[model samples]
Target: MKAEFVCTDCRKQFIAEGIKNEYTDPVYGPCVIYTAECPLCGGEGREYSPNQGGDDHEHGMGPSCPSGGCCPGCGGM
Candidate 1:
């Protein structure tokens, strides 16, 4: 399946195909998840929900940098 993902290290966003893996989570119990790698950063990527803007911050990040990336508070841009 295809899903949106954000790199945990570099915070790059991209879409990639992944295979569903069935596993049991200690808190959520049995669950299915997709895993993929960031082609740009080669870092592990996590699925991102569309409902959550684009930034990963829970309360939202500060202003955007001149380059169109997150502010320095998030170590972005």
Candidate 2:
């Protein structure tokens, strides 16, 4: 499951393995946080989806994640 992520520093869109985090956010209650790291700049990336996240953008090439985990794809969870 390759999901798109945008780097905070470069704003580049890349596909990577997404870590699905489920926890209680206290004020927000249950929350699901997806996190990934950029392969190019080693910066943190926020999960992106073509359908809900935003419009389509160019994709970068690299391993899904540094941990080598599979990530979800576009138009999906």
Candidate 3:
């Protein structure tokens, strides 16, 4: 099955195939979940599929370097 997730912070979407449903909390009972990295933000978490194509580049998603040619937050100097 294909699983989809959307990053709330970056508003990015990603899709994954052959998702495995595994229980995270053993004590909390059976709770199947799929964990994957966000293709747009590269964040280690859930990712969702896109409703349409061409939206990926349109939103400038992903952890791409800024136009300034440097990572301001990471101090890429």
Query: lDDT per prediction?
Result: 0.70, 0.66, 0.54
TM-score of 3: 0.39
Per-prediction backbone clash count:
0, 5, 7
lDDT of 2 at 59: 26
Best by lDDT: 1
Task: Give candidate 3's total backbone clashes.
Answer: 7
For candidate 1, the 10 contiguous residues with the lowest summed lDDT are 58-67
Ten contiguous residues with the weakest lDDT in model 2: 55-64
What lDDT does candidate 1 reach at residue 43? 88
For candidate 1, write residues 3-76 as lDDT tens digits.
88877788788899865789999999999877679999788877876544555442234333433455556455
lDDT of 1 at 65: 40
Sort every candidate by lDDT, greatest first.
1, 2, 3
Give the alpha carbon lDDT tens digit for every residue of 1-77 in model 3: 66776655565766655356677686898777666666677665454544433333333343343343344444432
Please identify model 2 stretches exceeding 4 Å from their true place.
49-77
Instruction: TM-score winner between 1 and 3, please give it.
Output: 1
Error at 25, model 3, angstroms? 3.6
Please give the lDDT score for candidate 2.
0.66
Across 1-26, the per-residue lDDT of candidate 2 in tens digits comes to: 46888887777789999888789988
Which structure is stronger by lDDT: 1 or 3? 1
